[model samples]
Target: MGLILGKISVETPKYQLILKTADYEIRTYPPSVLAEVTYDPALLGDRDGGFMILAKYIGAVGEPQNSRPEKIPMTAPVITHSAEKIDMTAPVVTSGGGGSTPITMQFVLPAKYARAEDAPQPTDERVRIREVGERKYGVVRFSGVATETTAADRAEKLRKSLERDGYKLVGEHVLARYNPPWTLPPLRTNEVMLPIE
Candidate 1:
């Protein structure tokens, strides 16, 4: 596993400590898993939504045993292209949707990779996967199943806190899940993240 500097803090929305930074690893994918998946980045609105994701820090990268799902461990950092500050409150503009949004968003960075089924053949280097360099984020931690209602509730609370602190939201809230699907629902680790301006 690699070690990267992380800025740790405490957030009250979910009553848990938070760690934020850049240069950490993340595995991104197309929105195909959901019925509402869309490629038009514009479709990603200000509100939050449910997503099926498998995220973990680099330390946990490995093939699962007996074909069980792998347990990836995600750290407290984000990866971005540069160290420049971001405007969090600005909306993510996207091209209007056509019949179907292209599924070109599925690309994994150096520190992350998609599951075999979701990834292109190893030799297909045309996939646009690369490291994001440095990214700033605000993280709110919570335990239990990350249902839409629960995520929205926590996001609302965090949004209030961000506004109070004079931080504008940079993008839609991305929900990160850190547990296997078969795990007990009550013990899951979910995080709501918004880029800050």
Candidate 2:
């Protein structure tokens, strides 16, 4: 268990700009280290890996809106036994990996279910829909290159701070990156979030 810090915004954008920034931010960090606990061994396919696409919008909680296309970082998708037949693979890395090795991990949605819109399509696969429960989390705001070491360091500090504040550890550590990949490493904004009880 870790201490819970109050809310901290990671300079989130409202529309298509979000895709350019947030998506790049999420991909810049080491997803493998952050999502260690929920990583699914089965989903870790040969060479390629699996990931979960999470669509988040600003507005009332859970309200659906046709807002501009916003990009959010995705976690490796974790498939339950009922839908185990599907193949899970990691997202394609678009940038930031000139010489550095890309990290991989598994991601699990809470517990909901859904089918692919175009069912029976080889490329279209069934997916589970899960609602992220509301809970307190410790958040550390940062701006820089979301390297694996930096994310892990911030997470560790936030965890220690939360423990000092008497917050119980709840779930996995979440790294929210909010900068365009093209942005210089020192100018990027990244947030380290840890769910607490």
Q: How far out, in Å, is residue 159 in model 2?
A: 0.9
Could you give candidate 1's per-residue lDDT for residues 1-197 as a string of tens digits? 01111123311111222444241122222322111122322344312211211121112334421123434333322211111232333211111122122212221222333233432222222222232323445667776766555665666666667676677666655555554445466555666666565
What lDDT tens digits, residue by residue, belong to model 2 across residues 119-189? 11111122222223234545666776655456656666666666766667655464555443455666555
What TM-score quantifies how close candidate 1 is to the native fold? 0.43
lDDT values, one for every candidate: 0.37, 0.35
Candidate 1 runs further than 4 Å off: 1-130
User: What are the candidates' C-alpha RMSDs?
Assistant: 12.3, 14.2
**Pick by lDDT: which candidate is best?**
1
Clashes (backbone N, CA, C under 3 Å), per candidate, total: 15, 15
